[model samples]
Target: MKRRTFLGSVAAAGVGAAVAPGLLAPAVAQAATYKKRVTGADLDTNSRWQVAGTDLGIPYVLENGSIGYLFGDTFNSPWPEQQNNDWRSPVMLRSAVHPGEAGGIVFDSAAKVAGNGRAPEIMHNGHNGIGIDNLWEVTVIPNDGISFPETGRQLVSYMSIEHWNPGPRYSLWKSRYAGLAYTDNGNDFVRTNLKWFNDADNADPFQMWTMQRDGDWVYVFSVRSGRQDGPMMLRRVPWEQLFDPAAYQGWGWNGSNWGWGRPCSPILNGRFGEPSVRRLGDGTWVMAYLNCATGNIVTRRANTPDSAWNNEKIQVTFAQEPSLYGGFIHPWSGAGANELHLMVSKWTHGPAGNSTAYHVSQYVGSV
Candidate 1:
């Protein structure tokens, strides 16, 4: 079937609703929820160790003999707690060479503030006072590279939504904003200046994924927000034009559409976030993300990154715990074989508490 027609049929049937070529509509909309939950019950939960203490935001990079993760320690407490714990404002980067192995580079700053108090400059705000977190990098094999600076560079501004409480008169509005930047040292590494990818007013910037189709040029995918629906909006932008002021002027294609009834309609009422995309063997793109409402990890596939994606959403991991974050796929992990791995952090009772312990799972068969 043509891609567009397939998508139209899928949307008409409702998310996860099965369809027949010409069957009668059901008396009610199929339950827009998953029936099962996946959690860490039988696995060796104690095997995974903490990469850093006191920091929440985490992004990883895996390559031959090495795995790197970057995170920051700045805590954005809501109005009440903000009065006390104001000292937790340092950012850091760390890595491990082997899969379960551990070791890494740490970068910290002498300054501390709610927003980092730095000027907003650079791609997402590279030079701005915003704390640096949510890191991702592309690697060139044969020779691995990793380094850290005594004084880390400021990348973006972020606010934590987990810190707020809502009242009848005052609504809860919490979010994180990032400015992107990269640099080339006339040698191996090139750093691009940060650009404003988000504003401090709305939702927080959760995680970002990037893919390079041809060469030199790159495209970025981010999990932003739609406040009312509460689902993360998946957005994409070209690397070359990312830093331009006008780049944010018009909406560029990022696979899904904004409102209801479109091919790119928000799934599971918008609570999805932490998205990671991988090109399948057939050249189709598959995305795995957190289904917040059901607290399960689910998978969705698309013929292309732009439009006409499959409406049949599949639940991959059935974690019973509060599984809200961490979804990733490592394409180069096995020899000539693609492997899918997913992680879910355990639920926390409060902002200062640790994330639920994480659980990782591999795909059952080849894609």
Candidate 2:
């Protein structure tokens, strides 16, 4: 099992013991009301046409009103194997099922992969396998992606990893830098020239990102790669200047007042992994992620993206599911309803590869 998974099992013994004393106050109420598996082996979504098993089910609304899920490290093989896993680091899956509908979110097919498709990767990651160099990038993993409102242009943020080292948690992957890629037709993506952040700065907070749109501005939440012992940062840019790297301004405090500017500061301090932030219909902002300290998936709400995240931290998943991560909020959730559905990924590491439980799951929470 992975280090995080092992910690999760240990945390399951007692959530209170896993978490630091006084790190968080008691939750006012439980956020997770219902839970079920959405996609994986033996589920309805597993097949040759779409995802059999994958991770990072990051969701965003498309221009056509359908929901698009950005997945990482997908496999066409129904059962986990060491080789010939039909590997695709990044792939796109589309679904028309509404969150409020009776059945859970069901993926229809791949975005670009055609008939009898095997869920082909939408983006390029240079060459496959380890010890191979195809210029500066060896393997690029998609973190989070979103579609523009009017233009419908797709933008995804990714990390360029130099290599993956075996044994240990923090040293698992050595990332060179993080950058952005855009696609107008949804099939071909062009990597931008600007580097969002590099690994040279040990404390850079933009290594992982999750983006959401609010009116004329788009809000981005970021954390480090290891997803532990780091602070979450906030940034926003105008919709018109979406592709302009310099247009983004970070939220920071100077021991006096909080404002938006360069060199963003931490909005919340904790162990975070794969954060998901979305604006509710009533303008309330909800953020969800795997809290490594407590070994539980949690959600916190704030009035604004730059506001203090002092609200009650609601636990969305039980302490037992330690291998779970990637809490991507459904776009259509909480628009005019009281329930919010989140797409969460769960996987157990195996010597052959990933176990059959490796797939995306759903958790319904009260808004």
Candidate 3:
């Protein structure tokens, strides 16, 4: 999730090491903005993540009206005081819950939901076999798209193994190959069908950030450049072809038309976090992401998924919380001044002092 990893020249097939940056026009003042509303909502559970653990940030409220919360390595508290939020379990966690009508959430402490177990295997070196293979995020697309089943499925993004060493020459641990893990009923995923498109030479070798339906096509928000601390790129494919690489189209600012199978262009500059996008009530698309440098969750609005966006507002900051990111907006948040709910994961100051916590916490209210 750091920015410096995208340094070396890519060896992709014909895409070249240098992709021309799309120049942005002079800015205009924006009207739609954000204001801090909800801080956080904590959960009560034990060490096994039967109820508690960190790394529970990326979430998808299922079409069947349940919440599917995806998490990375979970922290297993060693002490009886569940608040002792220290120590981590090497495996991933997928916790689910039924949203209550009263605005509170309750997850079953007994439900057998074991997230992606162990590391990734498809063409991954994992820092020469030492990095952790993790699935960074998950997306749930309705089955209405073409060639898809009548029932919706989840598209989980995979992050190959990598070592974490933050500093100059941070390209030591690079994410080479990432792809999607398909799921039918939201919880159970088909492990054998894992498909990956290598990002070694291309711009976006990771999961296409957050994807949303923009009219007839599903717009994919992806990160490349510095991987995390990089511009947000745009890609689109018809609803029925969301998983078809050949059907994908990249935004061509100069041509003003989508160039099918062409290279992607930077749509948003600066270090934007993993973006969570949704179509607003007025038809404009709004994306919520952490401004990594500032440690604040910001929102941006655009007329179309692939258009220039106006910086809306900074909603929440990590003044006390520290590494709080993964601002995932709830699908039920329907436009206008209605309340916006974010499923955010923050790195708490651990028991051993400053170690980053990987717990997924929830925040309610609006922007």
For lDDT, the strongest prediction is 2
lDDT of 2 by residue, 97-166 (tens): 8877777777776767665466677777763334123345556778787787588698888877655432
RMSD each, Å: 12.8, 4.3, 8.2
Q: Estimate each model's TM-score.
A: 0.47, 0.85, 0.67
Model 2 lDDT-worst window of ten: 12-21
List the candidates ranked by lDDT, beginning with the highest: 2, 3, 1
lDDT of each candidate versus the true structure? 0.31, 0.68, 0.46
lDDT, candidate 3, 22-128, per-residue tens: 33332233222223221122333442243334443454544454444444433344221245443232222223432213444444422134432222211222323
Per-residue lDDT, model 2, residue 85, is: 66
Residues 1-367, candidate 1, lDDT per residue (tens digit)?
0000000111121222222221112122111222112223231111122111222223333222223232222222311123342222223222332222122122221111122232111112122233334432111000011212222212222322222232111212223323333323211122343433434444433323333232222333444432112323333334345456444322232453333222222222334444555554456565655544344455555565544444424344333333334444332222122233333333333466434333222232122
lDDT of 3 at 77: 44
Task: Give the clashing residue pairs of candidate 2, or none.
Answer: none
RMSD in Å for candidate 3, one decimal?
8.2
Residue pairs in collision within model 3: 12-201, 54-358, 54-359, 55-358, 55-359, 56-360, 126-131, 146-240, 199-205
